[model samples]
Target: MAWKFRRRVKVIPGVHLNFSKSGISTSIGVKGASVTLGSSGAYLNTSIPGLGIYNTVVRPG
Candidate 1:
Protein backbone atom coordinates (compact mmCIF):
# COMPACT_ATOMS: atom_id res chain seq x y z
CA MET A 1 0.00 0.00 0.00
CA ALA A 2 1.21 3.51 -0.90
CA TRP A 3 0.08 6.84 0.65
CA LYS A 4 -0.28 10.01 -1.43
CA PHE A 5 1.04 13.35 -0.17
CA ARG A 6 -1.60 16.10 0.23
CA ARG A 7 -1.06 19.85 0.50
CA ARG A 8 -2.44 21.64 3.58
CA VAL A 9 -4.59 24.72 2.90
CA LYS A 10 -6.05 27.36 5.23
CA VAL A 11 -9.81 27.78 5.53
CA ILE A 12 -11.46 30.57 3.55
CA PRO A 13 -12.43 33.82 5.24
CA GLY A 14 -15.95 35.23 5.63
CA VAL A 15 -19.12 33.28 6.57
CA HIS A 16 -18.02 32.24 10.04
CA LEU A 17 -19.63 29.04 11.25
CA ASN A 18 -18.95 25.87 13.17
CA PHE A 19 -19.88 22.26 12.47
CA SER A 20 -19.34 19.77 15.28
CA LYS A 21 -21.25 17.34 17.50
CA SER A 22 -18.54 16.53 20.00
CA GLY A 23 -20.35 17.95 23.04
CA ILE A 24 -23.33 20.09 22.11
CA SER A 25 -26.10 19.94 24.69
CA THR A 26 -29.50 20.32 22.98
CA SER A 27 -31.10 21.59 26.18
CA ILE A 28 -30.06 25.11 27.07
CA GLY A 29 -29.50 26.24 30.66
CA VAL A 30 -32.73 26.74 32.65
CA LYS A 31 -31.54 28.95 35.44
CA GLY A 32 -33.97 29.61 38.33
CA ALA A 33 -36.23 26.83 37.03
CA SER A 34 -37.02 23.24 37.94
CA VAL A 35 -36.71 20.90 34.99
CA THR A 36 -35.88 17.20 35.14
CA LEU A 37 -35.35 14.09 33.04
CA GLY A 38 -35.34 10.36 33.63
CA SER A 39 -35.43 6.95 31.98
CA SER A 40 -39.19 7.32 31.81
CA GLY A 41 -39.14 10.69 30.09
CA ALA A 42 -38.56 14.44 30.46
CA TYR A 43 -41.05 17.09 31.42
CA LEU A 44 -41.31 20.74 32.41
CA ASN A 45 -43.04 20.53 35.82
CA THR A 46 -43.02 24.09 36.96
CA SER A 47 -45.79 26.00 38.68
CA ILE A 48 -44.38 29.12 37.13
CA PRO A 49 -46.89 28.61 34.29
CA GLY A 50 -45.63 28.59 30.73
CA LEU A 51 -42.03 28.21 31.82
CA GLY A 52 -39.48 27.86 29.05
CA ILE A 53 -36.28 26.63 30.70
CA TYR A 54 -35.20 26.61 34.32
CA ASN A 55 -32.96 23.72 35.40
CA THR A 56 -32.29 20.08 34.64
CA VAL A 57 -32.67 17.11 36.97
CA VAL A 58 -31.80 13.46 36.55
CA ARG A 59 -34.67 12.07 38.60
CA PRO A 60 -37.60 14.44 38.44
CA GLY A 61 -40.39 14.01 41.02
Candidate 2:
Protein backbone atom coordinates (compact mmCIF):
# COMPACT_ATOMS: atom_id res chain seq x y z
CA MET A 1 0.00 0.00 0.00
CA ALA A 2 1.10 3.48 -0.79
CA TRP A 3 1.01 6.18 1.83
CA LYS A 4 -0.08 9.67 0.93
CA PHE A 5 0.58 12.90 2.75
CA ARG A 6 -1.89 15.75 2.92
CA ARG A 7 -0.84 19.36 3.25
CA ARG A 8 -2.73 21.77 5.45
CA VAL A 9 -3.37 25.26 4.17
CA LYS A 10 -3.96 28.18 6.48
CA VAL A 11 -7.23 29.98 6.00
CA ILE A 12 -7.49 33.72 6.35
CA PRO A 13 -8.31 34.46 9.99
CA GLY A 14 -11.61 36.29 10.55
CA VAL A 15 -15.38 36.13 10.59
CA HIS A 16 -17.38 36.92 7.49
CA LEU A 17 -21.05 37.81 7.27
CA ASN A 18 -23.31 38.69 4.40
CA PHE A 19 -26.90 39.84 4.42
CA SER A 20 -29.24 40.39 1.54
CA LYS A 21 -32.92 40.62 0.84
CA SER A 22 -32.80 37.15 -0.65
CA GLY A 23 -30.63 35.36 1.90
CA ILE A 24 -28.36 35.60 4.92
CA SER A 25 -24.94 34.08 5.44
CA THR A 26 -22.16 33.97 8.00
CA SER A 27 -18.82 32.23 8.50
CA ILE A 28 -16.20 32.03 11.23
CA GLY A 29 -12.85 30.34 10.84
CA VAL A 30 -9.71 30.65 12.87
CA LYS A 31 -7.88 27.35 12.68
CA GLY A 32 -10.50 24.72 11.93
CA ALA A 33 -14.08 25.52 10.92
CA SER A 34 -14.97 27.06 7.56
CA VAL A 35 -18.24 27.86 5.81
CA THR A 36 -19.57 29.59 2.72
CA LEU A 37 -22.46 30.12 0.35
CA GLY A 38 -22.23 29.46 -3.33
CA SER A 39 -24.33 29.26 -6.46
CA SER A 40 -25.15 25.63 -5.77
CA GLY A 41 -26.06 26.30 -2.12
CA ALA A 42 -24.69 26.79 1.35
CA TYR A 43 -22.13 24.54 3.02
CA LEU A 44 -20.39 24.15 6.33
CA ASN A 45 -17.10 22.28 6.63
CA THR A 46 -15.39 21.50 9.88
CA SER A 47 -13.43 18.89 11.74
CA ILE A 48 -15.38 16.48 13.86
CA PRO A 49 -14.40 15.52 17.39
CA GLY A 50 -13.29 12.02 16.42
CA LEU A 51 -13.87 11.92 12.70
CA GLY A 52 -11.40 13.51 10.34
CA ILE A 53 -13.73 16.12 8.84
CA TYR A 54 -17.39 16.76 8.28
CA ASN A 55 -19.11 18.69 5.49
CA THR A 56 -22.75 19.62 5.07
CA VAL A 57 -24.46 21.25 2.11
CA VAL A 58 -27.98 22.65 1.82
CA ARG A 59 -29.75 23.54 -1.40
CA PRO A 60 -33.22 24.62 -2.36
CA GLY A 61 -35.48 21.99 -3.85
Candidate 3:
Protein backbone atom coordinates (compact mmCIF):
# COMPACT_ATOMS: atom_id res chain seq x y z
CA MET A 1 0.00 0.00 0.00
CA ALA A 2 1.04 3.58 -0.64
CA TRP A 3 1.00 6.02 2.23
CA LYS A 4 0.95 9.80 2.22
CA PHE A 5 0.99 12.59 4.81
CA ARG A 6 0.38 16.33 5.01
CA ARG A 7 1.32 18.86 7.66
CA ARG A 8 1.50 22.64 7.79
CA VAL A 9 4.58 23.88 9.56
CA LYS A 10 6.71 27.05 9.54
CA VAL A 11 7.50 27.38 5.84
CA ILE A 12 8.53 31.02 6.13
CA PRO A 13 8.54 34.01 8.46
CA GLY A 14 5.23 35.80 7.85
CA VAL A 15 4.22 35.31 4.24
CA HIS A 16 3.71 31.57 3.93
CA LEU A 17 2.42 28.34 5.41
CA ASN A 18 4.13 25.00 4.77
CA PHE A 19 2.54 21.93 3.26
CA SER A 20 4.88 19.11 4.19
CA LYS A 21 4.59 15.49 3.25
CA SER A 22 6.24 12.10 2.95
CA GLY A 23 5.83 9.11 0.55
CA ILE A 24 3.87 11.05 -2.04
CA SER A 25 4.75 9.04 -5.10
CA THR A 26 3.43 6.31 -7.31
CA SER A 27 6.53 4.58 -8.65
CA ILE A 28 8.88 4.53 -5.68
CA GLY A 29 8.06 4.32 -2.01
CA VAL A 30 10.56 6.89 -0.88
CA LYS A 31 10.79 8.39 2.59
CA GLY A 32 11.68 11.87 1.43
CA ALA A 33 9.90 14.94 2.69
CA SER A 34 9.15 18.19 0.86
CA VAL A 35 8.73 21.67 2.34
CA THR A 36 6.95 24.04 0.03
CA LEU A 37 5.80 27.61 0.59
CA GLY A 38 2.27 29.04 0.52
CA SER A 39 1.36 29.44 -3.15
CA SER A 40 4.25 30.37 -5.49
CA GLY A 41 7.84 30.78 -4.39
CA ALA A 42 11.24 29.11 -4.24
CA TYR A 43 11.26 25.84 -2.26
CA LEU A 44 13.25 25.20 0.89
CA ASN A 45 14.30 21.55 0.50
CA THR A 46 13.47 17.93 -0.28
CA SER A 47 14.98 15.61 2.28
CA ILE A 48 14.90 11.90 2.98
CA PRO A 49 15.53 10.66 6.47
CA GLY A 50 17.86 7.64 6.32
CA LEU A 51 18.25 6.97 2.61
CA GLY A 52 19.13 10.64 1.98
CA ILE A 53 17.29 11.45 -1.26
CA TYR A 54 17.36 15.23 -1.32
CA ASN A 55 16.69 16.69 -4.74
CA THR A 56 13.94 18.27 -6.77
CA VAL A 57 11.88 15.30 -7.99
CA VAL A 58 9.47 17.25 -10.16
CA ARG A 59 9.06 14.17 -12.36
CA PRO A 60 9.45 10.58 -11.22
CA GLY A 61 12.71 8.80 -11.78
Candidate 4:
Protein backbone atom coordinates (compact mmCIF):
# COMPACT_ATOMS: atom_id res chain seq x y z
CA MET A 1 0.00 0.00 0.00
CA ALA A 2 1.09 3.55 -0.59
CA TRP A 3 1.51 6.03 2.22
CA LYS A 4 -0.88 8.94 2.30
CA PHE A 5 0.33 12.48 2.60
CA ARG A 6 -1.26 15.39 4.43
CA ARG A 7 -0.73 19.13 4.44
CA ARG A 8 -1.80 21.98 6.69
CA VAL A 9 -2.22 25.59 5.68
CA LYS A 10 -1.88 28.59 7.95
CA VAL A 11 -3.34 32.04 7.58
CA ILE A 12 -0.12 33.63 8.71
CA PRO A 13 1.84 35.37 6.00
CA GLY A 14 5.03 33.74 4.71
CA VAL A 15 4.52 30.55 6.65
CA HIS A 16 3.78 27.02 5.49
CA LEU A 17 3.71 23.60 7.13
CA ASN A 18 3.22 20.09 5.81
CA PHE A 19 3.26 16.47 6.85
CA SER A 20 3.56 13.12 5.11
CA LYS A 21 4.09 9.44 5.68
CA SER A 22 7.83 10.02 5.62
CA GLY A 23 8.00 12.97 7.96
CA ILE A 24 7.03 16.53 8.75
CA SER A 25 8.29 19.80 7.35
CA THR A 26 7.78 23.52 7.60
CA SER A 27 8.79 26.63 5.72
CA ILE A 28 8.69 30.33 6.48
CA GLY A 29 9.38 33.33 4.28
CA VAL A 30 9.22 36.99 5.16
CA LYS A 31 11.01 40.17 4.33
CA GLY A 32 13.56 38.53 2.07
CA ALA A 33 14.07 35.76 4.57
CA SER A 34 13.25 32.06 4.44
CA VAL A 35 13.69 28.97 6.60
CA THR A 36 12.85 25.27 6.29
CA LEU A 37 12.79 22.31 8.62
CA GLY A 38 12.22 18.68 7.76
CA SER A 39 13.23 15.08 8.35
CA SER A 40 16.42 15.59 6.33
CA GLY A 41 17.38 18.42 8.62
CA ALA A 42 17.08 22.15 9.14
CA TYR A 43 17.86 24.73 6.49
CA LEU A 44 18.06 28.47 6.44
CA ASN A 45 18.09 30.74 3.41
CA THR A 46 18.32 34.48 3.48
CA SER A 47 19.48 37.42 1.42
CA ILE A 48 20.83 40.72 2.61
CA PRO A 49 20.62 44.06 0.92
CA GLY A 50 24.27 43.73 -0.16
CA LEU A 51 25.55 40.49 1.35
CA GLY A 52 23.87 38.39 -1.29
CA ILE A 53 22.36 34.98 -0.56
CA TYR A 54 23.19 32.85 2.45
CA ASN A 55 22.30 29.21 2.92
CA THR A 56 22.90 26.88 5.84
CA VAL A 57 21.99 23.36 6.89
CA VAL A 58 21.96 21.36 10.10
CA ARG A 59 21.51 17.62 10.45
CA PRO A 60 21.38 15.14 13.21
CA GLY A 61 24.68 13.49 14.14
Candidate 5:
Protein backbone atom coordinates (compact mmCIF):
# COMPACT_ATOMS: atom_id res chain seq x y z
CA MET A 1 0.00 0.00 0.00
CA ALA A 2 1.07 3.55 -0.63
CA TRP A 3 0.49 6.49 1.66
CA LYS A 4 -0.20 10.03 0.51
CA PHE A 5 -0.29 13.32 2.31
CA ARG A 6 -2.22 16.45 1.40
CA ARG A 7 -3.44 19.51 3.21
CA ARG A 8 -5.56 22.47 2.19
CA VAL A 9 -5.58 25.84 3.92
CA LYS A 10 -7.99 28.62 3.07
CA VAL A 11 -6.21 31.87 2.45
CA ILE A 12 -9.51 33.71 2.12
CA PRO A 13 -13.13 33.16 1.18
CA GLY A 14 -12.44 31.89 -2.32
CA VAL A 15 -8.76 31.15 -2.22
CA HIS A 16 -6.81 28.19 -0.93
CA LEU A 17 -3.28 26.87 -0.71
CA ASN A 18 -2.71 23.16 -1.20
CA PHE A 19 0.23 21.28 0.16
CA SER A 20 1.16 17.74 -0.71
CA LYS A 21 4.10 15.40 -0.67
CA SER A 22 4.72 16.22 -4.32
CA GLY A 23 4.53 20.01 -4.11
CA ILE A 24 2.35 23.02 -3.45
CA SER A 25 -0.54 24.44 -5.42
CA THR A 26 -3.05 27.26 -5.28
CA SER A 27 -6.77 27.22 -5.99
CA ILE A 28 -9.00 30.20 -6.60
CA GLY A 29 -12.75 30.31 -7.20
CA VAL A 30 -16.12 29.37 -5.79
CA LYS A 31 -17.47 25.89 -5.06
CA GLY A 32 -18.52 24.76 -8.50
CA ALA A 33 -15.68 26.32 -10.45
CA SER A 34 -12.04 26.87 -9.70
CA VAL A 35 -8.57 26.96 -11.25
CA THR A 36 -5.60 25.19 -9.77
CA LEU A 37 -2.01 25.99 -10.64
CA GLY A 38 0.71 23.70 -9.48
CA SER A 39 4.16 22.36 -10.25
CA SER A 40 2.75 19.69 -12.59
CA GLY A 41 0.66 22.15 -14.61
CA ALA A 42 -2.33 24.45 -14.62
CA TYR A 43 -5.76 22.87 -14.36
CA LEU A 44 -9.36 23.98 -14.62
CA ASN A 45 -11.51 22.21 -12.03
CA THR A 46 -15.29 22.13 -12.10
CA SER A 47 -17.91 20.27 -10.15
CA ILE A 48 -21.51 20.14 -9.03
CA PRO A 49 -21.44 20.96 -5.36
CA GLY A 50 -23.95 18.36 -4.21
CA LEU A 51 -23.98 15.76 -6.98
CA GLY A 52 -20.37 14.69 -6.57
CA ILE A 53 -19.71 15.08 -10.26
CA TYR A 54 -16.50 16.80 -11.26
CA ASN A 55 -14.14 17.38 -14.15
CA THR A 56 -10.60 18.57 -14.62
CA VAL A 57 -9.02 20.11 -17.67
CA VAL A 58 -5.35 20.79 -18.17
CA ARG A 59 -4.54 24.27 -19.43
CA PRO A 60 -1.73 24.54 -21.94
CA GLY A 61 1.05 26.79 -20.92
Candidate 6:
Protein backbone atom coordinates (compact mmCIF):
# COMPACT_ATOMS: atom_id res chain seq x y z
CA MET A 1 0.00 0.00 0.00
CA ALA A 2 1.09 3.55 -0.65
CA TRP A 3 0.26 6.67 1.29
CA LYS A 4 -0.08 10.13 -0.16
CA PHE A 5 -0.60 13.56 1.36
CA ARG A 6 -1.99 16.65 -0.35
CA ARG A 7 -3.54 19.93 0.70
CA ARG A 8 -5.01 22.79 -1.32
CA VAL A 9 -5.55 26.41 -0.37
CA LYS A 10 -7.46 28.94 -2.42
CA VAL A 11 -5.50 32.13 -2.76
CA ILE A 12 -8.16 34.08 -4.58
CA PRO A 13 -11.16 33.61 -6.83
CA GLY A 14 -9.18 31.84 -9.53
CA VAL A 15 -5.89 31.01 -7.93
CA HIS A 16 -4.81 28.17 -5.66
CA LEU A 17 -1.75 26.78 -4.00
CA ASN A 18 -1.18 23.05 -3.68
CA PHE A 19 0.98 21.33 -1.16
CA SER A 20 2.01 17.70 -1.30
CA LYS A 21 4.78 15.33 -0.33
CA SER A 22 6.47 15.99 -3.66
CA GLY A 23 6.44 19.80 -3.55
CA ILE A 24 4.25 22.83 -4.13
CA SER A 25 2.24 23.91 -7.17
CA THR A 26 0.28 26.96 -8.20
CA SER A 27 -2.99 26.49 -10.04
CA ILE A 28 -4.80 29.26 -11.84
CA GLY A 29 -8.19 29.26 -13.59
CA VAL A 30 -11.84 28.51 -13.17
CA LYS A 31 -13.86 25.31 -12.85
CA GLY A 32 -13.54 24.16 -16.44
CA ALA A 33 -10.03 25.25 -17.31
CA SER A 34 -6.77 25.75 -15.47
CA VAL A 35 -3.02 25.67 -15.59
CA THR A 36 -0.60 24.35 -12.99
CA LEU A 37 3.06 25.13 -12.61
CA GLY A 38 5.24 23.41 -10.06
CA SER A 39 8.54 21.84 -9.27
CA SER A 40 7.66 18.79 -11.32
CA GLY A 41 6.52 20.64 -14.44
CA ALA A 42 3.78 22.64 -16.08
CA TYR A 43 0.37 21.30 -17.05
CA LEU A 44 -2.82 22.37 -18.74
CA ASN A 45 -6.04 21.04 -17.19
CA THR A 46 -9.54 21.08 -18.53
CA SER A 47 -12.84 19.57 -17.44
CA ILE A 48 -16.57 19.67 -17.57
CA PRO A 49 -17.80 20.36 -14.06
CA GLY A 50 -20.87 18.12 -14.12
CA LEU A 51 -19.99 15.51 -16.72
CA GLY A 52 -17.10 13.97 -14.79
CA ILE A 53 -14.86 14.45 -17.80
CA TYR A 54 -11.41 15.93 -17.42
CA ASN A 55 -8.05 16.03 -19.15
CA THR A 56 -4.52 16.98 -18.22
CA VAL A 57 -1.70 17.71 -20.63
CA VAL A 58 1.95 18.32 -19.98
CA ARG A 59 3.12 21.70 -21.24
CA PRO A 60 6.38 21.55 -23.12
CA GLY A 61 9.09 23.64 -21.59
Candidate 4 overall lDDT versus native? 0.73
The reply for model 3, stretches above 4 Å from the true place, is 1-31, 38-40, 57-61
> Per-residue alpha-carbon lDDT of model 6 for 1-61, expressed as tens digits?
9999999999999999999999999999999999999987899999999999999999765
Identify the leading candidate in terms of TM-score. Answer: 6
lDDT of 3 by residue, 1-61 (tens): 9776665444344333434463221222224544443333434455767876677634223
lDDT of 1 by residue, 14-42 (tens): 21122233221122223344333334444
Distance from true location, Cα of 51 in model 6, Å: 0.5
TM-score of 4: 0.46
lDDT of 1 at 23: 21
Q: Can you write out model 4's per-residue Cα lDDT over 1-61, one digit (the tens) per residue?
A: 9667788676488888867777778888775577778878777766675667665666642
RMSD of each: 15.6, 10.0, 14.2, 5.6, 1.2, 1.1
Instruction: Give per-residue CA lDDT, model 2, range 1-60, as digits (tens).
Output: 966543333344566665544455556664456666645466666667566677655654
Candidate 6 Cα outliers beyond 4 Å, as residue runs: none
Deviation in angstroms for 30 in model 3? 12
lDDT of each: 0.34, 0.57, 0.42, 0.73, 0.95, 0.95
Candidate ordering by TM-score (highest first): 6, 5, 4, 2, 1, 3
Using lDDT as the yardstick, the better of models 1 and 3 is: 3
How many clashes (backbone N, Cα, C below 3 Å) per candidate?
A: 2, 0, 0, 0, 0, 0
TM-score, predicted candidate 5 vs. hidden true structure:
0.91
Q: Judged by lDDT relative to the true structure, which candidate is superior, 2 or 6?
A: 6
